[model samples]
Target: MTPTSALLSTRPWPLLLLLTLLLPGLVQAQQPTAVIAARATLSSWSDPLESLGTLRADESVTLSATVTDIVRELNFRDGDTVEAGRLLVRLADDEAQADLRAAQALRDERRNAVNRLAQLQSRNLAPRADVEDARAQLRQVEAEIQALEARLADYRIQAPFDGRVGFRNVSLGTLVTPGTELVTLDKLDVMKLDFTLPEVVLGQLAEGLSLTATSPAFPNAVFAGEIASIGSRVDPVSRSVTVRAELDNPELRLRPGMLMNVVVQRAPRNALVIPESALIPQGQRQYVLVLDEDDDYRVARREIGIGARRAGEVEVLEGLAEHDLVVAHGTERVRDGQTTRLLGILDDDTSIPELLRRGRDQAEANG
Candidate 1:
């Protein structure tokens, strides 16, 4: 300082200018850098198995007629919800109706004859053989009537179960024969999702396991379901087993033949978790900046072992503890032993950009 002070004294204006320029930097160095941090939390984590699946109605059937007849009346409109035994279509049955009436007339005549013969036999005026013959004739007429009724039933179409009907395939006066497609019916109260998983995970497949599904048609909606059954046999070529899950479709938003993404969660366990942004890859290792609150909030670089990652969260297998705060944002600008000002805490629900914006607003308000 002896020689330097003499020089500085001679040129005090230059020294003052240097101090003026360096003072701001000195102040900035003393101040801590702002960073967004998050605490390592113990949370329930599960390994997810993802696969493509197709959605089908819980119960689906094609409604058809069994006898050739003209559609005399259409009892249901397109897309109508029908109940079991509800008649959806009525075919022309005038001819059958006439035949049934004639059979009924004959049945009544036979019954009267049997009664008359019984009365005469009771009074010893008719032979027992004649009474038996009348009784046999009455039974034969009754059998014929039953057969005609059954044949008449085939001319009408009824819903076998409660379900929604598809578009009208046949209209009034359209003649339909046996096995002719009338309309499609599907039970849509519950949907069935079928997917295949590799045989390796067959052990994890079980009835009643919870799963989630999403379809492109409803981007924001998530469908929850449970495994209903596991296929009895595995596919030999694909080495996969089919799994069927049942989803409640109270709103009727899901339809048959919809492609969906399925995720099956398995092996749930408690683990230390941190935001994925905190991980910094160094060569083959993952590192994070952990804050030492006791040492004036200084940050230290730490190597951590990572396991499964999910939804922007990393499962910490080692080198972290519960409640250990780690630098989540502005990590690139920070160095070892550097103190950091916690702008905000990052959570699963809070994002990094949101925290940074909040931090900036807070800083502006403070200023």
Candidate 2:
């Protein structure tokens, strides 16, 4: 007998055990590995520019008294919303009111005298000079009444615009004078966000560019706004330009002097994007398994240049094209030139188990 046959016969059980182990490996090597893949798609991508910003009211003012007097009537409380021309405070105007009434009564008497003089002069009983003098006296009294009315106005304080008032600085019976801050008023229906950006990006900035802002106070809420104005001149010291954005504050959630994080959204352009899971990092290099449908769905390892990433997606700058299928799951079981069974295309919501179950059901129905 041949030497090989003799050895095999002497160790028959050992040979059988080796064959049993080798048979499954050979079968497994030939079977296609099931994998879920995603197609690289052209999607809108915006390069976001981030910076710190401060929130400001659309209009703000410090309300104060215009004259020195004791506070008589307090028309507004702390944090009261008022409209334009709303009465807010009335100083002690008793003396001014009394003077106005006296002047008005004197004006009435002078007018009656002028009328009576004119009636007599028409009959040639009164001289024309006397009639003219009476008319002049009436005009003088009317001017005095006007002066007193203006004086009374200075004793009252009214809102200049529609806004919300801050805490009261003066209380009832408190004596106040010109420039004494009584309160603060701010238009809170719309808020202004001011931030600075490097002048290098001035070419890309324009009024009406959309942006988003966020505050630590509201973790989950995102506020939307648009650029309202750009600073006319760049700041020489910082080499940056101030940008103002307007945000509607219908809920009054944004307040003045609040710190916010701003993200300026530049123009969007179409870019090739794939699922982030498709990336395989190898020593600072990113690689992905691209499926070749023309070659029996064989996978080819390709190096790709990556750019910005957001959520579960990544921007592929190179080595990928629109509609190119890449393995998104089960990448570990794949190799170059290895045939793979495509379960389905993956999306933002689908899972690997769901794709496997779908593939199995299809196979069963076909069988």
Candidate 3:
């Protein structure tokens, strides 16, 4: 017999088979264990409703001239905050002033004549017809003066309300006509956001319903508002109902005509939650490897039912019990029925003494 064949024949066949069977187990045990851990938590979860909206001024108007006239003086600078009844513009009133003076003189003359006529009538020195005529003339002259005074008021422009004004379209010598655009005034103490929602959701849209909005201009900031009004009818074309919301704008950061993303919350409920990293998908099924209740740190695959997700957390609708530890951070390296090492629960960083106590307990249990 050859030397190699003789040596192989001397070794027992049962012993050789046993060693081959044990080799795979030894190699698996020597492999480094992946470290990943998370404890399931109970948390509040709500499915958020979202929609697109537009921001608007609470109150807005365009200032204009009441009559045709040349602008003689401007009382406000562009983009100035003004108070109610503050003069904004003055129009040239030279011709109106001349007519007013003439009317006043005629009124004064008529008044003198009426006084004389009254005295004459009391003395019975003049006929009743003459006194009546003189009094009628006085009335006509006083009416004329009043008409002139009313006309003069048209030359002055004043703010109808307290607000901020935009740029003026006319200059000092520019002549403006009635209905001519002068400037814009907006009351910005509060802002109105108008948007539409599908008619199917009419039950959810109501006065006092709270909502939140965000804008690209202020990406990190969120504005809170409430539904102020609902439209009487839904638009036939879009099948949506218009809704308006009011938001307090103390800082005046939000401006009209800005596009915003809006979110509304409905009824919320408490649910068990876990980090999204703990999930693993295979074929058409989703699962998580939870640490088995043993000192060996073995993990088992668990199928889970999921619900609405927000931020980095996912709601566990089923299959996950509270306080159950699962592989979260290093799920990619974990396998079903595989050995692993505990790195503490996710986000469980705390005092060093607690960590040491946990380590000692685990060691004692394993030993």
Candidate 4:
């Protein structure tokens, strides 16, 4: 070809545009599809035992006045963290104080009168019955005074424990009566979530069986705790046993009545695992999507036996090699030998304790 002919043929700009318009399918066939990319990972899946639970504090108490009185002063405000013996509310004690003073004065007077009567009786001036009457009067006054003091003390509301106080219900001068809901007090520094788990695996759950928890208040965050209490007997009807775990809520962030999901960690000395979302069930078989580098990803139907389901992940038993990535998502849509785009890799080999600690830090930072 001549120089001009070569230059004319070299112009791919116009030809490319024509091919784009005329051969759309041919052009598209040469391109790659990034259909909801998901990372391939090997996860050790443990047989999962699903359990339902309700969130609750280990110890929660509501404050109420036992006597009818006007609130003189609220020593502590709402959300106040109080120590044991901390005074919370004080009722109008003017009448009680007056009564106590009168009782004391009358007791003193009766004692003096009794002494005088005893002296008279010894000198044969007063009768034995008179002395006995005086002594009885003094004893009556003393008893009365003690009773008044006891009643006076009840006028003050105190913290029964080292705990956090709820919002104030009755402010200063608010008339409150017996059974009046004053406020809620809870020991949140350490909280417990009472739950029930299937009693079939009683051996799996015991003291020191690890656990992880997360609440809606802080999503993507896990709180750490241990199996604190286990019921001695399992209910035959429900086939479930009560399990309670104590969580260190030092910041008082996790409150009672806050719903949460708990994961009990069974120790894995040398475990295989993968992301939970990666596993898809087809009939009786479960599998994951895995990529072998390049665009050479495949929907691998893995026969994985699992151990424990925890924190959006699971432990695997069979049908997967270490580091052999299984697809995380879209396994149902993918077929064996089909191509896939590698999305991201999830940590399936990290120590459970490390994972728990990292989750706790994330929760604290967010909180």
Candidate 5:
């Protein structure tokens, strides 16, 4: 009390009052701030066209019985990989087999008659008409046998191509008729993806161009493929063209009807690239707080022109130069020409874009 009162008593009352008011602001200005940052760099950027697509099997079909019969055997299980011509299902073929046998016996008997008649004709004992009639009977019996054999083939269901079989709808001993679906077969070694894009970009698209695709089923995996075909005409209503690409799926992980996100790179050019998180959009203008060139710890707001974005990076068309530092995080806490101490420079591998994505993933997991 004595020291504080002595100092206060010697100072003017106005001076003491003024000092008390300034102390809080001085302390606030000196407080340390923690934030993440990145440098604007000169790099080549491609306008990556993104679109939603559907994955389809290279070949697919619903295996169905061609004729009405009771199922005798099912040689495949649900989701089994099979080769072309592999026997899939067998129907009760007893009646078909009996018919074939009867046809064969009749043909054999007719052949014997034809031989006897031919011998008689050579000896001039039987008329030539008799030999001709026997020969015609033999030919008719052979035709009946051929028809029965063809009908017999319908009882055995075989795979049309190499593929994976889906769940069976009809089990052994189940009565099935023609056009009844038994199972589904899909060739998954390669997948076809169909997507649509604006007709304006059609001139840039061509066959054999490489593309990448990602699916929600396997978020961490990326599948690479190439453009297999392009649409011949653009849709008048949507003014878009349908594109089809083929992806090699050696692991057979991708299945038909799965939705995928596709990225197609087009028109590469050199530009100033920055983390997409650094752009601060306000009203109709965009801004970035760039570190001051003279004072590395200070930042100043600058309006920027932006172009196409891909991954976690955005193309800076103007108002920024290579090698300029920009505050990527904690922008709301910063002001133009304010002093800021960067926690540390962003790691080359840990860009702000990737970090933001990780943050979003964590939030989703937590929820």
Candidate 6:
């Protein structure tokens, strides 16, 4: 049993009360229940497919090394924002600089020799073979010098792209080798949300469909996104397909690795709605205790084609009308053909927008 079930199960008296109440004319006629009721409503039913999703950075990287050396300087602090090619870290480049100077000297000497040989070749005084050999030697030395220059530049590490840098795992003055971890960089301007959908929903899924998601950090704020990708293959065991949505996280608050609830809404259509608490499930049969025109409370069987639930209201389909009134609470004490009066509704949705505004006003006043 669930924790709620266990707590309520503490008393077997309610179970007995329910059994007696369901019996025909078992409860005394003079007894009146303090129950709740809500007038039925018509809503633009939204076929919103909701699921748990995880947020991830659109791009991430582990900045490391291409050359090994003693650490000299770290250009950024932990959690600093960096741009593409911005200096991040640097290593001791004394050896690299020496090698560069040596390469330049050799290259200069070779160039002079090549120039002298070319003049002689023009005069037809130097051997043609000598000129060819000088050209090859110059080219060889020049190529080596270029390679050394590149290695020297690698000593100063720079950011590869615009991103926020993570905590520095290593400190300055620490000797590091090639592939040593420096820091992590993440582009958080956009995020990707990953979720799975039943195979039946795959038919309606498409690229650029809208998504609304909520997280605990910002309770009232809803983040929007569009379908970025959908897996072509379905999982055999779960019969679901993977889906990814791209979110524009402009505030940089929607961080990667956040767990959240995602709601995918289709176009709005018509549906009948009643309070969720009113719908009671007896075995496989779903029933709602409702009040008819004659002010009689009865356990009415309903074929419920369910839809999205929002703001404490549940959308119902089949066997209901807008003018219908459903018993919101006190259902456990009601029976089929039991006479009951209209009690105040707990989830009455009449004038919802006004009610919501009033709630907000009351909260502000209380605060």
lDDT of 3 by residue, 6-77 (tens): 989988987989999999999878875756577799986666678899888988999788889899998998
For model 2, the stretches where C-alpha displacement exceeds 4 angstroms are 1-22, 117-139, 277-288, 292-297, 300-312, 316-323, 330-332, 351-367
- Which of the predicted structures, 1 or 5, would earn the higher lDDT when compared with the native? 1
Number of the top candidate by TM-score?
1
Give per-model TM-scores.
Answer: 0.84, 0.80, 0.65, 0.60, 0.64, 0.64
Model 1 steric clash pairs:
none
In terms of lDDT, the poorest run of 10 residues in model 1 is: 343-352
How much lDDT does candidate 1 score? Answer: 0.92
Clashing residue pairs in all predictions, respectively, total: 0, 0, 0, 22, 0, 0
For residues 1-367, write the lDDT of model 6, one tens digit per residue.
8999988877898888888877756554555554556778776666688999999888999988877788898899888888999989888999888888988898889889989988998999898899889889889888988988888778888888888999998888888998988899999899999999999888898898888999999999999998999997999999999999999988899888998799987665677787777778767756776676564554454555555677767877666777777777667876677666544444534543454456567658966
Native-vs-model 4 lDDT?
0.74
Instruction: Give me the displacement of residue 270 in model 4, in angstroms.
Output: 6.1
User: Relative to the true structure, how large is the alpha-carbon lDDT of every model?
Assistant: 0.92, 0.91, 0.84, 0.74, 0.88, 0.80
lDDT of 2 by residue, 1-367 (tens): 9999998788978888999999989997888998999999999887888999999999999878888999999898888889999989889998888888888899889889999999999999999999999999889988998888888888878898999999987778898989999889999999999999999999999898889999999999999999999999999999999999999999888899999999998866788999899999999899999999898789999999999998788999999989999999989998999999989898768887899899989989986
Q: What's the residue-level lDDT of 136 in candidate 5?
A: 90
Lowest summed lDDT window (length 10), candidate 2: 344-353
Clashing pairs in 6: none
| Better candidate by lDDT, 5 or 6 | 5
Residue 279 in candidate 6, Cα distance off native in Å = 15
lDDT (Cα, tens digit) per residue for candidate 5, span 173-209: 9999889998899999999999999999999998987
Report the lDDT tens digits of candidate 4 across residue range 1-367.
8999999888997898988787977865654333233333444333334454566766789989889999997888778889989888899999999999988988889999999999999999999999998999888888998899889988988899988888987778888888998888888878877788887788887787767788878897778888888998899999989998888886778878887787776543556767678777778777666665555665545566666667876767776777676665456666766776443344535443454456567658966
Off by more than 4 A, model 3:
1-34, 39-44, 94-153, 266-271, 280-304, 319-325, 332-340, 347-367
Pick the winner on TM-score between candidates 2 and 3. 2
lDDT of 3 at 296: 67
| Residue 65 Cα positional deviation in candidate 1, in Å, after optimal superposition | 2.0
